[model samples]
Target: MMTFYNKQTTEQKEFYENLLSSLASLSKLFSSSDTPYLHYRAHEILFCYAFGANNISRGDVSFDATKDGVGIGLKTFLHGNGNTFQKIAEFNSVSDEIRELGSNHNDIAHFIADKRNERLTDTLSITSTKEMLYHVITRNNQSLNIAECRMSFVEKARIKKVTLKKNNIYFKDSLHEYNFSLAKNTLYKKFDISENILHSIDVNIMGNPFQLLENLSVFDTKESTKTMEIILPLYSTSTGDVGRSSGLNQWNASGRERHQDEVYIPIPSWIHNQFPDFFNYKGKTTPSFMVKLPNTDLVPFKVCQSGGKALMSNPNRLLGHWLLRDVLKLQAGQLATRQLLRQKDIDSVLVTKVEGKEYDYELDFLKYGSYEKFEESHKE
Candidate 1:
């Protein structure tokens, strides 16, 4: 697991200091209530106010607070400890919305640990933890490590896919009804949609959602540049569809062993429509194009612009592929375009084709030894 330093730079210190102050005031106002659920709302409300994210009727989803919305809805987890959480029925909304929202089994949740310090002004840690577990099972007098035996099975269990039935009373409180503070404070004032932190979030925002970061790093500092992974699909206003470009030829490359640490980002035809100059090559050769991405200071990606499509398969592992399919979070033939953007942010892009299934690093590893291999396999 990668760890980020707790120390803040001058700019980070200034921004967080005011953010903590705003949180302090909000905490005080909500602290007056004796209700346990209200305390939870304080966290949800803080997320909304501080970052312009808003919750639905019963805390099912949080949308981007920006004007240009990203269609994805962030999964929210709030409490002193996030080791466990409950999902109750949302009676106010239609059953279908609740079922659809509930069935999405993605582990990408915006987590806020309300770890109370002596003072409310203390800086809070907004972190995400991937749910990983290992266990040993015995069958037919033989011992088996379940994780080593079937890694996919272990991964599937962490996801929640079943519909909520009669006794499904996971969440009983209503965090949505209590409207606390939407106005800005120091922390809220400093919040910007362009920040890289928003890219990983699955929530929806109010306004025009900020353009998704082209790449994501696990660490906030530059020393740990190549470790970031794009866990969420980003929305782009200018390029139209900018993400793990589906329908492009599977990236097939040599030297899989040497390129184990590399990352891959596909560029679809829509990108060509926007930047025709970059991919105007008419030959069969895979050409290279250099261009700057939004909200990141990393070096320009090593792009292979071919057949009106481009992909970033950096040999040094700079841009990792989005592992949506590897985890089975998305199916190949489903109407997955809806899953790409937050529900509210869907209007930002004209939906031309649904994002059908595509290959991931793990699949590439099985077919070829390299995690970055992009060899086009026969489309099933």
Candidate 2:
């Protein structure tokens, strides 16, 4: 379980409080008896959820992570990417079904209370309780799917340097020590702030808590250095995919160790398409990052560790993610180049490459180890 901090800098904390209050009040305006155009209010509610990530990923860590765990940043993308969200109104093949359902529900709500006397189909239709539950589950599933798509990209990436301190709970591994903060810069690129600001005010406007030095003391913070990392969950994302992406948590654990007192640099993802140069920091080599599939045994698979070495026995077969500028290269001809994908040499045993069937972390986690490792050992 990744825990977040209740403590925060004053400015970061206040900005979050104001932003959250705005989101909540905007949502309630929908349920008002005098609400104008109910459907429009619903859109407003969604907009609040979608474009409001900086707030959710800020302030007290626990509160911040909850919003991020869902796909609340969606409004930002939907708005920026050529109004792709408005397509729900146009009802294209890929977007119509859900929107139609929501629209229909609004019509029903409008009709049942026309100030007249038409309490008619209360016995046969999808009741409000059923509708509410349906919406909850549907939104949750959608959020999960959105996450899969967002993490799918393994383009030019970067690993931010992170430090772990005491009284912080972290997932234990067999090799490297790891810690998580729902706050800024942990799994995202380090933000740039002035030296006077970093030392005196000490906060990240970019919402990257992993870069907060007055609040952090593990990684080396030598003048204006960008030290962050990428997260190594079981999930992987490539281009042009749909639905919830998968992870590799089924066949193995990170097998890394966690420390209660020791300080170590962790990894985060790249914000832009590039990253900073690497140095040989202890534990920066093997603990917090790695690339392994569900099965097909490989050795010396040290993607993240204390040293700056790639350190893999079968580098070609393993699908590890690295800071974009760190290890990936363009092959010249192929239009769709790849990074953080399965290595080239390792034999792929695909009985059938279906969802949760071949190599993903989440399915394996939910079905096997957390459930009991489901195996069909080969007789050959």
lDDT, candidate 1, 162-280, per-residue tens:
22233221111111111111111000101111211211211112121122222333545533222111111222223444333332112223433333223344444444444344434
Best-matching candidate per TM-score: 1
Candidate 2 lDDT by residue in tens digits, 153-220: 11112212223334221222222222322221122211111111111111112332234435665765
Candidate 1, superposed: residue stretches over 4 Å from native:
1-15, 19-266, 275-300, 316-380
Q: Model 2 Cα displacement at 278 (Å)?
A: 5.6
The most accurate candidate by lDDT is 1
Task: Give residue 371's lDDT in candidate 2 (0 to 100).
Answer: 10
lDDT, candidate 1, residue 96?
36
* Candidates' C-alpha lDDT: 0.24, 0.22
For all candidates, the clash counts are 40, 55
TM-score of each: 0.26, 0.19
Q: What is the lDDT of residue 141 in candidate 1?
A: 13
> What range of 10 consecutive residues in model 1 has the weakest lDDT sum?
118-127
Error of 1 at 132 (Å): 13
